[model samples]
Target: MTDQISDAQFTARTLSEALPYIQRYAGKTIVVKYGGHAMVDERLSAIFARDVVLLKTLGINVVIVHGGGPQIGKLLDRLGIVSEFKGGLRVTDEATMEVVEMVLSGPINKSIVRAINQAGGKAVGLSGSDGNLIQAEKAQKTERDPDSHIEQVLDLGFVGEPSAVDTSVLDALLKSNSQLIPVVAPVGVGKDGHRYNVNADTSAGALAAALGASRLFLLTDVAGVLDKNKNLMREIAVDAIPDLIADGTAAGGMIPKLETAAQSVKHGVGAAVILDGRAPHALLMELFTEHGAGTLIS
Candidate 1:
């Protein structure tokens, strides 16, 4: 933190320079997806919580959608529950879905809420099931067997994607209430009253789109979307993501994040950025500085 900026004078200058940005985003919504390395590292988590509190203090309506994959996996291991994956998505059955909900909505969600509250902000933890914030349907996919060369359906039990989202809960929270931040777990409820495990990044993107949020920030481990040489591409047009994915530049978990970011931007989100959550105050750097902190896809 000390090295990022020179000294106190620079800090003061940064605050002075950020007045316009502060004003520009005041009363606007920003949805932050908190996960990856940031969720694990104690120091990073504390920093992120403070950053969120600061954003709210500045009148930026912040909605946090958080992921707890590693935590869930850890607990599942403890319980001796077998976990599986199809493509990059988790294959969540009924038993695994129970663990997902327990860890995500119970401990992890409240922990984040507590962190923000301890940092002097009012935060309410929620799941997508609360108020039917997200209506989910089973996610579908197909893949070809290498030897058979025939595509077959891959059934990931209980896993879902966002079918619809209701923002009445958010409107009541963000617009009609006191100064509050929402920390949401990615768990969703199906129309048939079944619980579905939704991917956090996908859920966050969908929520951002539904709210017409000013910015959707996906804070992850990497610097941002990189090129073939792994150089960070500072700014990207939404249309260019397919080429990057096709050329194999975006792979693994990053592919979903890129796809989500592009889709959010297309769905009327003001801006979507993939940035390193490992860095201290990374959100502040991106929002307030001239040279931002990550790859911004507008």
Candidate 2:
């Protein structure tokens, strides 16, 4: 009986802690970049779907941008195609582009949409090509080995960087229905009349910037950014980003993620958070609890 009473008290405290955040972000837009382990795990996926629904129910506008790297890789293997990456960007040729489109738009997007719907959220799945929502340009070839005196250009074919975003479609959807949530697959159409694969984090950052979102959340597998001691850093200012990158703390795949976060903050997004998607109720904890569970970049 005492244990049951404690549990009830804990639940009440949790709800009380969340009240401020719910009030603060009501009617504000939050762009969530959903990827990493959470996307593949059925349990985490359901939790994520429910979290999005809860946010919507509390009057927050939620936009999800998702990745399909593992799925794409599996498809490529099945098709007997070899895949490579240049500067962490997939070297997407014509054949690979076809598979990317199929995987991202067909199964992954629909699955997320279904999950959200099941959780009582009205979700519409879309690609960047839908309604010309995201306009992208081919990423220019970069010099591969500058130190080796090799001015060779490496072309990551069909890999695009978002050049512009038309938020009119999103606005229309939001205005037409208050409960509408957009689940975007990071596949865009290029000016060259070709389908291009955009990085999900990059797409989310650009969308946040375009919409002037109040918050941008990057849900990854890890426990957010760490210092030299591997301790999670709670907050980072935009000015310190260069130092972090220079000291090798933010290298490899984390570089792009941090860069996107900094860029979003610089471009007028209120704040960007890197949260562990594997944590149960991580979204709620990060958004509502006093001692949040991730790194906040502003």
Candidate 3:
């Protein structure tokens, strides 16, 4: 009986601490790029859905953009399709694009929507192609040869980047009194009627900027950006991000995530955070507590 009473007291105190944050974020929009281990682990996924629903219950508009690269690859292998990567992006041909869309828009998108709905939230699953939400053009990349410094534009077939984002559908759903959460897949349609596989991080940043979101949260595998000694850097100025990349502090997949975060902040999103998705309730802790869960770039 005494322990039960103490637990109740702790819950009340926690709620009291979260009150200010709840009020601060009410009626604002936040974009979350949900991926990494959180998507695969059942326990983590359940808690993530609950956290998102809690945010919605508090009157915060939340947009979820999800990735399914591994799933897509697995399906492609099962179907006997060969694929490769260029500049860390899958070289998506027509056949590969079909599978990419199948995985991202079908199973992954619907699963997240189902999880949120089961958690007592109304979630609408959408692909970037739905309602032309994300208009894209073929992406062009340049790589220099290591032996000789010659830069050449490499054609990444059917792989595209977001050129413009139309938020009318999202705005209608969010503004409606019914309180619908939008879960978007990153498969975009090109101007020429071809479906393009877009990077989820890029799509989330673009959508956040277009919506003028209050914050953009990228749930990644790592804790956050780390210093040379591998300690988490809690805060980073937007302008200083480039130096981190040039100096090798941020390399590999982290470079693109940082670039997206910085671009989102510069283009109109209030701020961006890169936090570990593996940690349960990291999103909630980041938003509600004084000390956020990850590196903040503003």
Candidate 4:
């Protein structure tokens, strides 16, 4: 009985500490890029859904943009479609694009929406092609030959980057009488009437910028950005991002994520955080505590 009473008191104290943060974020919008190991882990995904509901209950509007690279690859392999990657992005052909859309816009998007709904929150699933939410252009890349130092353009068929984002559908849903959390899949339609596979991090940054979100949270697999010694960097200024990339502190998938976070902050987001999504209730720890859970960029 005494231990129970102590636990109750602790809970009360924690709530009291969170009151100020709750007030600060009330009525503001936040964009979350959900992906990585968190999507595959059942227990963590449940915690994430409940945490999102708790944020909405506190009057903070939340938007989710999710990725499904592993799922897409798995389906493509099963169907005997050859997969290729150039510069860390999938070289999507017409056949690959179909599978990407089917996985991202169909099952994965609905699963996330269902999770949130089951957690007692209203969630609506959407694709970037729906309502023309994301306008995209074919992405291009160049690589320099080590021996000749000559740059050659590589063609990554249907992969695209956002040119513009139309938020009318999202705005209507958020402003409706029945509040609904929007879960977006990152398959965009190009101006040439082609379907393009968009990187989830880039899509989330664009949406956050268009919506003037207060915070952009990227749920990643790591413990946030690290320095040369592999120590966590708690806070990074937007200007320092370029140097981090040039100095080799950031590489691989982390490059695009850091770039997206920097761009989102520059475009009017209050801040952006990249933290470990595998950690249970990471969102709550970052938002409500004095010491945040990830590396913050502003």
lDDT on C-alpha atoms for all candidate structures: 0.92, 0.91, 0.94, 0.94
User: TM-score per candidate, in order?
Assistant: 0.96, 0.96, 0.98, 0.98
Stretches of candidate 3 off by over 4 Å are none
- Per-residue lDDT for 173-290 in model 4, tens only? 8883546999999988888778899999999999999999999999999999999999999999999999999999998889989999999999999999998998999999999999
The segments of candidate 1 whose C-alpha lies over 4 angstroms from its true place after superposition are: 1-6
Error of 4 at 260 (Å): 0.5
lDDT of 2 by residue, 1-298 (tens): 9999999999999898789888999888999999999999999999999999999988889999999899999889999999988856679999999999999999999999999999999999999999777889888867658589776777998889999898887887677347999999988887766788999999999999999999999999889999999999999998998999999887778888999999999999999999999998899998898888999999
Q: Per-prediction count of colliding residue pairs?
A: 0, 0, 0, 0
Residues 96-115 of candidate 3 have per-residue lDDT tens digits of 98899999999999999999
Spell out the clash pairs found in candidate 4: none
Candidate 3 weakest lDDT stretch, 10 residues: 83-92
Q: Write one digit per residue (lDDT tens) for candidate 1, span 1-298.
A: 7766678778798799999989988889999999998987888888999989999989899999999988999999999998888765678998999999999999999989998998899999899999999899998888888899999899999999999999889888898446889999999989998999998999999999999999999999999988888899999999988988888988888888999999999999999999999899999999988889999998
Give residue 123's lDDT in candidate 2 (0 to 100): 97
What does the lDDT come to for candidate 4? Answer: 0.94
User: C-alpha displacement of 66 in model 1, angstroms?
Assistant: 0.5
